[model samples]
Target: MINSFEVKETNEMIEKENLDVRTITMGISLLDCIDSDLDKLNENIYNKITRLAKNLVKVGNDIERSYGIPIVNKRISVTPIALVGGSACKTVEDFASIAKTLDQAAKDVGVNLIGGYSAIVSKGMTPAEELLIKSIPLALHTTERVCSSVNVGSTKVGINMDAVKLLGNIILEVANNSKDNDSAECMKLVVFCNAPDDNPFMAGAFHGVTEADAIINVGVSGPGVVKKALESVRGESFEVLCETIKKTAFKVTRVGQLVAKEASKALDIPFGIVDLSLAPTPAVGDSVADILCEIGLEYAGAPGTTAALALLNDQVKKGGIMASSYVGGLSGAFIPVSEDQGMINAVEAGAITIEKLEAMTCVCSVGLDMIAIPGDTKASTISGIIADEMAIGMINQKTTAARLIPAIGKKVGDKVEFGGLFGYAPVMPVNNYSCENFINRGGRIPAPVHSFKN
Candidate 1:
């Protein structure tokens, strides 16, 4: 029902505007893989992932060639390891071994990355979840192509301050573990509030307990396409600007819908949702901030930035939902300072700061993402940042996340190059005022009154 575009137009959009299916992620439920023995659990995970996703990369490549659409990544996600390994992983090392198995499976399957090496502790942590949290630095250090996420807050359950405080130190330790690579391991980790079950992106993607045994989810991104569409409506009325964005987003999501169907058919997996987001890359012209600039901001952190971002985000959802049969994940514009060249340029020009980025996150898809801070910043400060973002998501009842990288041995004046899609970020200064007392208070922040709905 969405075949309202000419083939030439779609190809032009892809050839010129940096449009691509960001990832074709297979969500494999590993609930049945649970076992009492650690070795058996690891073996189950590896065999199941390998068998179910064996053709994932090949199918993605086949679809890319068949349709001439670029599928940037072929990846996999499984049930959160915390629940799967609870009976088997009695020690931190036991959890780290699972990470190794995941890395090996991902390598063998030839996918870009494997997620769901994760824990969901939004309310409180079980003993097994606590061990997973403790093993993060070691697990990340010892493995490649494995991503980890922790959910520390939710609208119904409020903020988990105990888990939040613990992860603050774990984030720093994860960064320290990969300092030689500019702490790039931090790029593979995310701390979430209200994380979604079917998200196809990393490092926050996992097969939620509510999902089916196996499903195919597609992530499609095109900030460049949106930026180009806005250029045609320069100085137009706000209504016209909104309409143009919606139309462009519809087109983008349609592309993703097609790719999702083909991949599902090829892999014999059930079709999941299409996440059509304005997720940017480091390339010039492929930036969410650039779309904002075309929407009349001199820079992304300008005074009117948040309002502009809210408008863009709303219109994108409206159009994408119309095009796709199902739309989920964090389907809007992301504001990662490292991944968007426009954001990186804004940072270099001093047009954006961490505080302003936090404000922007209130309306954006993700929060305080891919931001780098000074190496010497206190862990309590990091906890304070997480608490603030989690509070925003909890009160607003929207999904939000923080992927802060404290680049070890780096300062505010210095920059870090992560290379490839992780890109690079100029270190931003964090507020030096201490919040140690606030962070040390080991209790949950109660959900706001608005969340009392039955």
Candidate 2:
């Protein structure tokens, strides 16, 4: 029920506010592709992905042209490879071979990135999952478009300190291997607690077991659009400001609904949820931090930053849920340092710190993301950071993730340029104090008491 006036407004938003569909992701299930033989396993994985997503890019293009809307990325998410390739990928190199196949499939289909090179070890790890985790450094270093993620904790299962410790070392290894690209490989890797099933966003997207054989999920973003709406009420009350954001989010989500339905129909796949996340970009005017500034903060990490972010995230969800029957994924404000220009500025101005970012994540969509820390930061410190975020997610029963890049050979104040969507980041300082004893104690942190409900 998009009326003429709404259509015109959407057109204006696209032209002026940097509004668009961030991604049209096709989730393909690879459960049936499992084979005990490594060669056949890879062949099945490649064939299934290519067959289902062959027209994904083309359909996205047609939608963009027909509706005069921009579609930034076309992505694919598959079943966690640890489950699908467990029988076949007996060694770390075997898993890396499977990653190569995924990279090739992405290139063949002309998609921006392919996800689900992942494992779920919230409680404990199986042999296959351990193997896949071990291969992440080499796999991400060798491949171009493949993304990897590991879920080391969840509300129901608690934190797996063992997996967290291993991933800390693995992330450092990934950075070391890809130092030539300023640790670009780490940009494609995510460490998660309570990861979502139908996330269309990259670096953490994986097709959950509950999903259908194939589906289409769209992630729509417009932080700039929200910021523009807020501008119309400079001196307004908090209630008025919240209303403005809700109305703007409603309008933005309707456009997403249109794109999702059209893409699903065109592809003959079931229409999955439309993720109403206000995902920011490196481009000017499209930042969650800027939206916070519009809320009267001098800089992003000013005193009231966390409160502003909470309001923005909650209102966006309220508006979006009313606009569409289905709203899921990390549908809130994202505060990735490298991807948001205002956040980058804040870090450079010394207004934002890693600790402040951690506090912000208590209310935002995800945890510390695309943050580059000094190269000398120890693996134990990284694990400590992950442990803290995981504890937050577990206690809050929300999805949180960390994509930390230990910029090899770089120190505080040095800049790491990853380019493109990965963007660039200044090396932020980490606490020099040691958390070695805590991380070295390898065991599961017990699940929250509320999780025991039957």
Candidate 1 lDDT, 1-454, residue by residue in tens: 4343557788988899999999999999999999999999999999999999999999999999988899999999989999999999988899999999999999999999999989999999999999999999999999989999999999998999999999989999998888888889999899999999999998899999999999999999999899999999999999999999999999999999999999899888999999987889998889999999999999989999999999999999999999988999889999998998999999999999999999999998979999999988899999999999999999888999999999999999699998888788999999999999999989899988877788
When summed lDDT is taken over every stretch of 10 residues in candidate 2, the lowest stretch is 416-425
lDDT of 2 by residue, 15-113 (tens): 999999999999999999999999999999999999999999999999999999999999999999999999998789999999999999999999999
Model 2, C-alpha of 50: deviation from truth (Å) = 0.8
Error of 1 at 416 (Å): 0.4
Model 1 TM-score, 2 decimals? 0.99
Count of clashes in candidate 2: 0
How many steric overlaps are in each model, in order? 0, 0
What lDDT does each candidate get?
0.93, 0.94
